[model samples]
Target: STQNANETQAVVASVLGLSANKIACKVKRLGGGFGGKESRTIPLACITSIASYHTKRPVRCMLDRNEDMAISGQRNPFMGKWKVGLDENNKLVALDTELYLNAGWSSDLSVAVMERALGHIDNVYYIPNVRAVGRCCRTNIHSNTAFRGFGGPQANVIAETYMTEIAERIGMTQEQFREMNFYKEGQTTHFDQELKDWHLPKGYFQLKEKSNFDARKAAIEEFNKQSKWRKRGISLIPTKYGISFTALHLNQAGAMIHIYHDGSVLLSHGGVEMGQGLHTKMIQVCAEGLQIPLDMIHIVETSTDKVANASPTAASASSDMNGMAVKNACDQINERLEPYRAKGLPWKEIVHHAYFDRVNLSANGFYKVPDLGYKWGENKGQLFFYFTMGAAVSEVEVDLLTGSHTVIRSDVNMDLGRSINPSIDIGQIEGAFIQGMGWSTTEESLYFPNGRLFTQGPGNYKIPGFQCIPQEFNISFFEDVTHESVKTVYKSKGVGEPPLFLGTSVYFAIRNALWYARQE
Candidate 1:
């Protein structure tokens, strides 16, 4: 729904004659779009629509992997240069960064992606004086599109690289270097958004203790001193990902619910089910809102005809906005049924009476999350409603002879406030983390000098399969946590994209092992 509305606009413009009012774009739920489908889905639709209009028949366009690679884009490749001032103690004093993102063939979402990159280059650290400039550099290759973490991972990697290099310079562990500079309570981000509900420390310490990072670091040092061929390394990382879109208008969602005479419910929301369990959690939120059993509520696929001008299901804030919309719809119906309940009637009987008594059985609900803006000129505003805190420690063994590494173990700690559905949230965390791990570790993009991608298919490219996953993958959630800043449904935080950036722990761990191997 987020980009579907835009697709309609694109189609209308591409047709070169259709007025906006003459066309209606009805969209159903999409599958697993981590920002890729948001912008890339436009080109195919517009091209096909034009063909359909000329031919007077429905047109279908399908591109195989090679063809798709030839047209579509991958994550924008980034290059940055920076000047940093560190005090004698190696604490960061100021950071000035100028980033250039390869926009590829054209400027698609590269500018917006650059904005997110600039915002995240700080990566939760408290730098008193920081300045940044980002430019989208055009190239001859296919236009780069969005991937899972948007541009957060690329920027965070930059921050973490500096953190590690400084740590080594000062003879301190990466954890110590990072923790010493964390944004404490009552502090503010570079954008002047006052930091609140700080959970990074809470998760970082617990993850370190559980992962036994210090002991493992010591042991790895000793092992590397003896083993020349195989070197081991361990790294711990913390991340703070803000929820909501860079654009404020994309922060809202709508839901429509119907209560039948039999007390059954039909739920429709503008959230696409990309296998992150948005539908399942919405059902849970709906059932809990109406105080009904889960089986009593049914959700239909998201369609534009059902919810107009819906926001795209990116930003990891889908559940936040859609859940609130579902809650609003259920609340209205509950108010209508309150009288029947006071008469000591069952749910079905209440619905029967409410229907006959002329009480509205169907309600359309809408919600827009607050704190959706920031002022660049003044460097002030609530940029994020709340933070999704996470920390991870990954240990790896690198083969010095061949540039291959294996993740021995990974421990992750997340503070999701109170998860709507623990299982679904856990599944999201796992899936996002794994996908992110692939991006930083096994997934590499190669291109020929002529601007054509060489790794166009799986035969030439590689992705992390199950065999590459950490042998001891441990995940722990922060218990009894509640967000007091703003009441997001059930006090739950965003889960979809936050964990994706945490997977960089594996990359850094591999680097650490390689650093040891180089010494030998």
Candidate 2:
């Protein structure tokens, strides 16, 4: 488990100036981080380690909620300027964007965040002549760090904003414009990654039919016309998120599996469980690989001693890489137990024999995502192992008098190839979309003149609650998912950070209602 995969490296190499092995960071659990703990949390540990080193004794340092909020990083606020060129048929011909990200006070992870933003500038569309320039501006506040979706959410907002403007400028419905401009199966992205197993439009159209979007759009229009101070709107938005680290070295993972004499198993992997069910998935992966019942395998804690030099649990690739490593470890154990099974021995008897035979009951496994990463300078290699694709149809009703709004309904369709657990995957889809919705709509951060955060706690700031959820929400998976793009773990795609951008549909739908209101 990791917030900073390099925390030990940072403290060892930089703070104490000691060997990497001199320090070990142990992670027991993370309730919820949302990228807040990715890199910015390094400073906390570094400072504490320094205090302990100098004092020659144990030291504990903790901050209250106010102190944490006042000093810690926030999401990078962005300002973007763009120009889009569309052909006579409204097909995207070219797009040029200048994105300025506020990297408050320190650089932190701003560069990597900006790169993900630049890579995502096209979102789910294909623009032939697209050029994106990103600037990480220095500001006078606590350094902004990774939030959920990293830089992709900011980029999606810019792309969708211009897309909505273009649709209205040409007197076309938002749904029709977005559908017509989607990338076909053979299209390659601006960054040169080929769109294999392209299912963005597949899920998009299916969601359209399942949600009855066409009829609802017309019905909303009639309702808006009859109402005086309230207007209704509907929109369809799609997401295509790359599912690996942009940094090549972070693409590897390690797992350690120990089979005891009693045939019970202890599995340790290089992934943090932050209320996301990562440990549960790894247990399943281990159980499947070992061909045993789920109850026989128990996942130990995530610690540096268990799996050294592990990657951060961010990037949504923890499962993709860690699950593979667990599988490899299980395979090693199975191979050792093969002879016993050939002799018609049961699992417990095989384990007992293997323990007595000294057949290496403990296995260390490692895996590196093959053919991964992109060169920022060349901009021509694969940025991801594969892409996680999904689409959403959201309908919003906005109050003209008070500027309040309600989400009438939302429909989401995703291409999660052979979901390891449909219940968990759907929960992730729901949680991520709601979090993204909060970012785009009600969740606003304020600042004082001297660079102090005004919205430090829930009292001043707002997050989505039960009342803000859609009145009707539907979720469906693409039945014809193919893993030809990249053979991920269990032929399943990453779901943690991809469905987040689909929440922008609510924002776009609200914009549509506001657009119609402006006409009056």
Of the candidates shown, which would achieve the greatest lDDT relative to the real structure? 2
Would you list the C-alpha lDDT of every candidate in the order shown? 0.83, 0.87
lDDT tens per residue, model 2, 1-520: 2376556555645778888777778777887878888876777778877888888988777777777778888889889999999998889999999999999999988998998999899988879998899999998888899888889889988988888889888999777888888989978898898888997887888888899988998899899889989999888888889888888998999999999899999999988888888999999999889888999998877888789988889888888899999998988888888899899888889999988988899999999999876887797788878888888999999999999999999999998887888889999999999999998999888889898988888787798999999999988998666676568778877889998988889999998898888889
Candidate 2 has which clashing residue pairs, if any?
none
**Cα RMSD (Å) per model?**
2.0, 1.6
For model 1, residues 317-346, the per-residue Cα lDDT tens digits are 889999999999988888888888899887
> Best candidate per TM-score, number?
2
TM-score of each: 0.95, 0.97
lDDT of 1 at 380: 68
True lDDT of residue 253, candidate 2: 94
